[model samples]
Target: MIETIVFDIGETITRDDRYWASWADWLGVPRHTLSALVGAVVAQGLDNAEAIRLVRPGIDVASEYRAREAAGRGEQLDESDLYDDVRPALTALRKAGVRVVVAGNQTARMGDLMRDLDLPADVVLTSGEWGVAKPQPEFFARVLEVAQAAPEATLYVGDHPANDIFPAKAAGLRTAHIRRGPWGHLWADDPEVVAAADWRVESLTQLARIVSA
Candidate 1:
C-alpha cells in the first residue's frame, strides 16, 4: 500500500506557465524559446542550472530573484494556478488515509506562495529549509526520514523523468509519470524512459483512482 504521496510543486500540482513566462521576459527571450531550451536541456540530460548559464551567459539568478522580490515583480501563484485535478485528487487521497506532502526544489520564500494557494497538503517542505534539493540523494533520504517512511512504501509523483522519476526510483521509491506538463509530455515518445515508470497517469484524477493513496 502507498502510505505517502510526495508531490512536485511546479508544473505538477501548480501550473507555472506564468512563472516561466516571467522568467523568459526577464531574460529577454521569447517564452517559447525559453520553454524549448529547458526541454532541450532535459532531453540532453543536462543540469538546468548549467543550461540557464549557457543560454544567457552571465545571467545572475540570485540577483534577479532578489531584484524581483524587492520590486514585487515576481509573478505569484494563486489558487487558480492549481490544476483542475489537483484538489479533488489530493482530497481523495487524504480521505483515504494517505499522508500527502509538498516537497520541492524551492526556497523557503516560495513557502509563502504555496500558502497563498491554500493547497491541501498535510506538510509543506522545501530545499531551502531542508538544506538539500532534488536530484540529490540526501534530499530524498531526508524526506523519507521526516515522514518516517521506508522508501519502498513511498510514491513519488513528478513531471521530470530524470530529476524526479529516475532519482526517486534510485532511492527505491515507486514513481508515477504524470504526462501533463512539459517534462512529462516531453519524454512521452521515449518509450524506454517512460516505460520505466511504475505508472503513467495523464491526470491527477486518474492517479487517484489507481493509487491506494
Candidate 2:
C-alpha cells in the first residue's frame, strides 16, 4: 500500500556514469581520482554536492574538458544521449496513484542539468537550493511535506548508502538501494549494504514492480 516515492535523480533514475566521465574530462583528472575523492568525502559524511564544492575550488580537475567538448574535440557527449526509461517509468507510477518526488544535492546547475537531460521530475529538491543535503532527515522531511505524503506510506529509492539509505530509514520510510558500478570503494562493503535497505534492485524498472506490489 505504498502511496508515495522519493527518488534520488542522478544514478537511481538517470544514467550518471557518462556524466562522471564528462566531469573527469572537464576536470582534467582521471575518473578514478575523482571517484576516490567523492568516496572519501562521502565517507566523512559530506553529501555529494558539498563534496564537489569542497574539492573543485582547490584543484583544476577536468575544468577544461567541457570547453573541449563545446569545441567538438573531446569524447562524444550529450545529456540527451544518456537518458533511460525513468521518465516513462515515473509517469506510469503516477498514473498508478503513487506520488513521485525527486531529491538530490544538485549544486550549481540543477536547472540546467534537468533541462539538458529532459528528465521528468515531479518536484526537484537540491542542496544548493535548500542549504541542506541528503542523509540529513530534514531533507527528507521537506520532501515529504512537499509531496503531501506521510512517512509511513512513502518509500525512497537511491544509489548511495549514507545519503539515501540511513536517513530515509531514520525518517521511517522504506528504502531501495540501486546497485551499479563505477563508484569507488569509499562506499560501505557488503554488510552495511545488506543491513541498510528494505529492498535492493539493479534498476528502476525493478522498482516499478516494488511500488506496484
Candidate 3:
C-alpha cells in the first residue's frame, strides 16, 4: 500500500504563476513575455537561469538576491499561494491514513513559510534543509529516511518530468506527473518520458481520485 507521499511543492501544490509575474515586473517585461520565455526554455530543455539572464542582461543573480534582502522585499509564500486543489487533496490523503510530505528543491526559508501556513501534511522538508537538491539521489534518500518509507510504497508527485518524475522513478518510488506545470505541459508530448510515469493528473483533485482508485 502506498502510505507515504512525497510532493514537490513548487508548481505542484503551490500556484507559482504569481511569482513568474513578479519576476516579469522586476525585469520590466510584460508577464506574457516571461511566460513564453519560460515555456520555450522548458520546451528546449534549457536552463531557466540562462533565459532570465538573456531577458535581463547584466543580471547579477546573487547580487540581485542580496539587494532584495537588503530591501527586505522577499516574495512570500502563504496560503494564498497554494493551488485550489492542494488543501482538498491533502485533506483527502490525510483522512485516508496517508502520510503526506513536502519534499522539494527550495530555500531554507521555505520550510518556515510552509510551517507557518500549516499545510495538511505530516512533515515538510526542502533541499536547503537536506543540503541536497532533487535529480540528486541523496535528496530522495533523505526524504525516505525521514518518512521511514519503502520507496516502492511511496508516491512522489511533482510537475517536472526531468527533475521530478525521472529522478523519483530512479529512486524506486512511484512517479506522478502533474500536467499543470511548465515542464510537465511542455514535455508531455515526449512519449518516452510520459510512458514512464506511474500516474498523471490534470489537477491535485484528480490525484485524490487516482489514489483512492
Candidate 4:
C-alpha cells in the first residue's frame, strides 16, 4: 500500500507551458527548442546543475525572465496553473489516508507560486532549501524522513526521468511518471524508465486513480 505520495511542482503538478513559452519568447527561440534542449540534457544523464551549465553558455541565461527568477522576484506566467483536477484529486487522496508532500527543485520563495495557486501541500521540499538536487538518493531520503514514510510505501511522481524516477527508484520508492506536462515527450528512447515506473500516468487524474484505488 502506498501511504504517501510526494510530488514535484514545476512540470509535475503545475503545467510549465506558460513559463517555457515565456522563456522561449524572451530567448527568441521556438518553444520546441526549449523542449528539445531539455530532452537532450536529460538524456545525457546530466544532473540539473550540469544540464543548466551545458545549456547556459549556449543561451543568454541572464535574460529578463531568468534574471527575475534569480533575483527571486519572478512572477509566474500562465504556465503555473495546477492540473485541472490535481488539487481536488489530491484532496481526495488525503481523505483516503495518503499523505501528500511537495518535493521539487524550487526555492522557499517558490512558496509564493503555491500560495498564489492556493495549493498548500502537507510539507514542501526543495533543492534550494535542501542543498541537494534530484536523482540523488539523499534528496528523496530527506522527503521520506519528513513524510515519515518507508521508501517502499511512498510514491514519487514527477516529469523528469533522472530527477524523479531515477533517484526515487534508487531510494526504494515506487515512482510515477507524469506524461502530459513539460518535457514529457523527451523520455522516448529509454522507454524503460517509464515502463518500469509503478504507474505511467498521462495526467494527474490518472495518478489520483492509481493512488486512491
Candidate 1 to truth, TM = 0.89
Q: TM-score per candidate, in order?
A: 0.89, 0.72, 0.92, 0.78
lDDT of 1 by residue, 56-137 (tens): 7897887877888788777577777889989999888888877888888887877777866767788888888889888899
Q: For residues 64-136, could you state the per-residue lDDT of candidate 2 as single tens digits? A: 5446657765543345544366777777888788887877766435535554554555676666678777767
Query: Which segments of candidate 2 are over 4 A away from where they belong?
Result: 30-83, 115-118, 183-189
Which parts of model 4 are misplaced by more than 4 Å? 25-66, 69-73, 77-80
What local distance difference test score does each model get?
0.79, 0.68, 0.82, 0.71
Could you say which candidate leads in lDDT? 3
Of 1 and 3, which scores higher on lDDT?
Answer: 3
Clash pairs, model 4 backbone? none
TM-score of 2: 0.72
Model 2 alpha-carbon miss at residue 34, Å: 4.1
State in Å the error of residue 183, model 2: 4.7
List the lowest-lDDT window of 10 residues for candidate 4. 47-56
The numbered model that scores best in TM-score is 3
Query: For residue 149, what is the lDDT in candidate 1?
Result: 73
RMSD vs true structure, all candidates: 2.2, 5.0, 1.7, 3.6
Tell me the lDDT of candidate 1: 0.79
**Candidate 3 per-residue C-alpha lDDT over 1-213 given as tens digits, one digit per residue, 9 for 90 to 100:** 787888898889887777678778777899999888887777788866666777988898768756665777656787789988889998999898888999898778878888889989999988988889988999889878876789988999988877888888998998888887787777666786678789877877766666677
